[model samples]
Target: MNAKKKDPIKSLGIYCHVPFCVKKCAYCDFCSFSGQNSQTIADYFKALQQEIRSFALARFNSDVGDLAFPVVDTIYFGGGTPSSVSPEYIQKTMAVINEVFTVSEAAEKTIEINPGTLSASKAESYKAAGFNRVSVGLQVWQDELLKMLGRVHQQSDFIQCMEILRSVGFNNISVDVMYGLPGQKLEDLTATLAELMAFSPTHLSCYSLILEAGTPMTNLVKAGRLVLPSEDLEREMHWTIDRFLKAHGYSHYEISSYCRPGYESRHNLKYWEMVPYLGFGLGASGFYNGVRSVNTSDLKEYGRLIAAGKSPAKYEPPMSEGELMSEWMFLGLRKLNGIDDADFKKQFNRSFFAIYQEAIDSLLKAELLVQDGSVLRLTPKGQDFENQVSLAFF
Candidate 1:
C-alpha cells in the first residue's frame, strides 16, 4: 500500500459518510443508526478504515478499465450527523486518507453537523484534523416546527452551535433551511431566513420538503393528520426565498443552493459537474471512470464483506453515451448560469444542438428555456418548473 503509482493521477472528490447519529429524524430514510452500543460504533470505524486502505491498494479496475490512484481535491463528511461521533474517529479516518491518497494541500475539507451535537472540543478537533468548512443543519428557526419535524435540537441549540463554531475559527459555514413544512407559513419562513442572515453564513441550502414513502412524516400526511402548504402557497414561498436571498447579497448559484462570492460547495459541485468521486462508509455511493457503485446499506453485511477482505460495493456498468449526454444536460442545467453548448461539444465531440434540437426548440417555444449567446439557461418561468425542464432532456 506504500508503493507509489506509475499511471497518471486524476483529481477526485472523496465523500465519507458518518452513519451514526444521536437520533434519526422522522423523515430521514438515509442509512444511519442511533442507539448503537459503543463497541458497534468502534467496529464500524475499524471496518471503514480497512475499506479505505483496500481501495487505495487495489488496481481500481472498472468498466472504463484500469485507472491510477486519485489525487483528492475535496473531501466531504456527511450524514447522519458527523458531529454526533467522537472527533477521534474522524481524525483517525482522515489520517488513513492522507496516508493512502495524494490529497491536495488546498483541498476543501467539509463536515456536516447538527445543532446540539457540536461542542467547542469537537470543533477544535475537527479544525486540527484539517476540516476547513462546516455545514450546520438548523431545519427551521421555530421550536414548534423543529418538534413537528422530529429534530432533537431546539432553536437555542442552533444559536449556541453557531457561537461555538465561530469561536473555534470556522468561518466557512453553511446552514440548511427547510420550507414547505406541514404548518409552515410565509412569515415563518421569512423569519427563519432573516434570523439566519444575521449570522452571515458563507453558504445556504434552502430545500422544499419532499415526503418520501415509508417515512413517518409521509404516513402522517397520508392519514391526513398533517397538512402541507398548498401548491400556490408553496410556489410563493419559493419566489419569496429567491427574492429575499438575492436582495441580501447571496448568488443563487444552483437550484437549491445560494452562496457568497467564491464560496460554492466545491465537493457538491463535483456531483453536478460529473467529476469523479469515491464514497466510503455504509451505503455510500461513488462514481468514477464512467461507472457507478454503491456500498451495501446493511451495516452488518458491510462489516462481513470487509472483514472477509472482499469489496462491499456493487458496481453498475459504464454509462452509455446517451446516458452521459442526457445527464450532462440536466445536471448542468441545475446551475443558474446553465450549460454551455461549446463545452458540451468539447466533451462529447458532437454538437449539443445536433442531438437535442427538437427538445430545445419545444422548450424555447414554450418560453421555458432561452438560448443566451452560446449558453442554454432556464427562464424565470422555467426555474419555477425546473423538474419539468430537467426531465425534458431525458
Candidate 2:
C-alpha cells in the first residue's frame, strides 16, 4: 500500500456532472453549451452508469475491499442544468448509483436547477427520488442586468421557479446571485437582494463576475462596448453582501456561499476541506486515493472515450505529503475560520512556522490577519485580497 493513500477523518462526496443546458450564458466559461434537440445528455448518462458499474467492479477487485470508500455520503448533481433532463433520467441515474455503491440514508443529495428548465412536477419528483436540496440559477433579479449577463430566464421566470419549489415543500433551496456585471449599480444589488430575500431561501451564493479571456464578454470589454463597476464600487458591493447576509442570520461558510444556520452545503464543503471525492463526467475533477484527476472538457472527445469503455481521466496527479499539507492550509483559508495550526504540524511533523515563517511575520506586521489562540484568520482586507494572502502559505 502507498503510505500516503492512507484514509483519514474526511468522508467522500460524489459529483455527477450534467453537461447539458437549455441555453449557454454569455459569460459562462464552464463546459456547457446549448442542448436543445440533443440526445447527448441521455447518451452521456448511459455512459456514466457504465462508469459507476466499473467503479463497483474496481472496488470488488481491490485486495483490501472494506477499506475502499464503499459508501457515498453526499451526491451532488452539478451542471449545465440537472433539470433540463427529465426526472426519469435522474431516477435512472440514482438507480444505477444505488446498485453500485452503498449510499447513506442521511446522505445529502442535491440537484442544480435552471429557472427556465424547472416545473412543479419535476421539483416534486426530485424530492420523491430523495433529493434533499435544490439550487436554482437566479444570477440577477433585474431583467436589464439579466439580459446583460446573457441569462435565458427572466426575472419573472425566476420568481415562478422559486414559487414552484416552495409550493412543492422544498425548504432547503439555494439561489445563485451575481455581481460586477456591466452597467450594474449599487441599487441593482440592493434591489435584487431584497427580492430574493423575500422568498426566504435557506441558502444563497453571491458570485462576482469573471470575464475569462476567450469569452465574448471579454471581447465586448476590449472593444470598449461594455462597462463594469469601478474597483471601489466592486469592493463596496462585496462588503454590502457580507454585511446584509450576516445581519439576516446567514453563515458565510466560504467565500461565495451563505446559508442559514444548519443549512450549509455538505457536498461543496468536501472540496474546500480538501477531502477525497469522485467526479464522473466531462470536464469534472476528482480527488481520491491520493490521486487527483480531471476528465477531458471537449464534448466530442469525452463521449468518444466513454463509449470506448474508458473513464476518461486526465492529469491524474498524485499528491505528496508536503504538497497535501500546503494544500490543506491554502484551501482551508478560503473558509472564514481559516486553517488549524496544530493540524498542519501533526500532518507534516514540522511546525507551520518552519515553512511560512517570513510570510506569517509579514502578514501579522501588516495587520492582514488576526490570531485568536491557534486559529489564524484573514482580516477583512485580507479576505478581499485572498489570492495574495493565500500565496503566502505556499
Candidate 3:
C-alpha cells in the first residue's frame, strides 16, 4: 500500500452527535427526539460505529495509505443529551475511536449531559472511559422556567448531577444557561448567575434565547399566548450577565461564553480558529481539508449508506477563498481578544488592512471596533451589534 503523507499543518477535532433525548425542549430545533425506543437507539449506535470504521478506513487508504490517523486533540460528544443513552454505549464508542485514531494523551474529551439523566454510575463510566470534561445543560436555575422550557429536570436534579460529577473526580465542568425567555426578568437572570457562581463551574455558556422558525416557543408567541422579552431588554440581559461574570473573575472569551482563567473550551476554540474537525452521526457537520460537509439527517438513510459502505454525507462543498476569508474574520471576531493581523496574513498571505480597510475604517469611525497593538477586537458597542459587524466581512 502506498503511504499517504501526513499534513503537518492539519490538527484534528472529533465531534460525535447523540440524537436521543428523554424529552425535547420546546425551543430546540436540533436533530434529537423524545421517547425513542431502546431498540432504535441500539441500532443507531451500531450504524454509528460502522460509519466511524468506514470513514477511518477510507481516509487512511486514500493517497495516505497505511499512515497513522491524525492525532486527535479534542473529542466532543454533543447531543440530544448524551447522558440520555446508556453509558456502556459511550464506552464502546470510545473503544472504537481508540482503535482507529491516535488520541492525544492530553486530549480534551467532553460530553454534554442533561441533569435529568446523569447518575453516579454514569459519571464513573465517563471517568473510566477517559472523558475529562462534562458540560451540563442547566438552561435556567429556576424550576418554573425549567418547566416552561419543557426540560425534564428541575433545579434539584441539576445540583445532584453536579454532586455526582464532582464525586467521580471530574474537575472541568461547564454549565449551559440561557437568558431572555418569555417571562424571564433581569432579576431572574441575576439570581441564576449568583447561584451558578456559588457552584464555581470551570466554564459557562450563556446564550440569549432565539425564536427559531417552526419551534413551539415561536408558535406560542405568534398565537399571542406568549410574549418574548423586547430586543432592548434582551440586550440589557446580555450586558448584565457579561458584567457579572467578568467581575467574578470569569473571562468573557467568546461572545456567549465565559470561563475561569485557563478553562476555555478547547474544542469550541478550534471552530473559531478554523482548525479542521471531523463530525460523525446523523445530522452532524464537519470541516475537513477545507471542505465543509453535513451528514444525512434521516436516520434510515444514514444507516443504509453506512451499511452499503457509502459516505453518509448529504452535502460536501469546497469553500472558495473569498468565503474562507470572510469566515476567518467572522469567527475570529467572536473572541474578546479578536483577530491578530499577523495570523491573518500568515493564513491567507494577504494584507488584512488592504482587504478590509473600508469596513475597518467605517466600524472604527462608528466606535464599534478598536485596534490595540496588532490585535483588532470588537468594542463594547460592537459586541452588542455582533451580527451587524459579522455581516460587514461578508
Query: Candidate 2, residues 1-394: lDDT per residue as tens digits?
Result: 1112224234668888888887778788887767445577777777777776766556544675535444578999898888988888888888777667667788899999989888988998988888989999998888888887787789999989988888888889999989988899998998888888898989999999998887888889888999988988988999999998888888888888899989889888888787778898778889887788888888778778878877777856688877787678778878887777797776677777667778888987777777776778878888788888878777
* Candidate no. 3 TM-score: 0.96
For candidate 3, the 10 contiguous residues with the lowest summed lDDT are 1-10
Task: For candidate 3, give the lDDT.
Answer: 0.89
Task: Specify the highest-lDDT model's number.
Answer: 1
Worst 10 residues of 2 by lDDT: 1-10
Q: What is the lDDT of residue 227 in candidate 2?
A: 90
TM-score of each: 0.97, 0.94, 0.96
lDDT of 1 at 121: 97
In order of TM-score, best first, we have 1, 3, 2
Give lDDT tens digits, candidate 1, residues 1-394: 4523546478899999989989878788888899988898889999999998888777453334355766789999997889998999999999898887888899999999999798999999999999999999998999999999889899999999999999999999999999999999999999999999989999999999999889999999999999999988988988899999999999999989999999999999999989999999999999988888999999999999999999989999999999999999999888989999899988999988889999999889988889997799988888888888888899
lDDT of 3 by residue, 67-123 (tens): 545778999999888899999999888878877776788999999999999999999
The Cα local distance difference test for each model comes to 0.90, 0.81, 0.89
lDDT of 2 at 356: 78
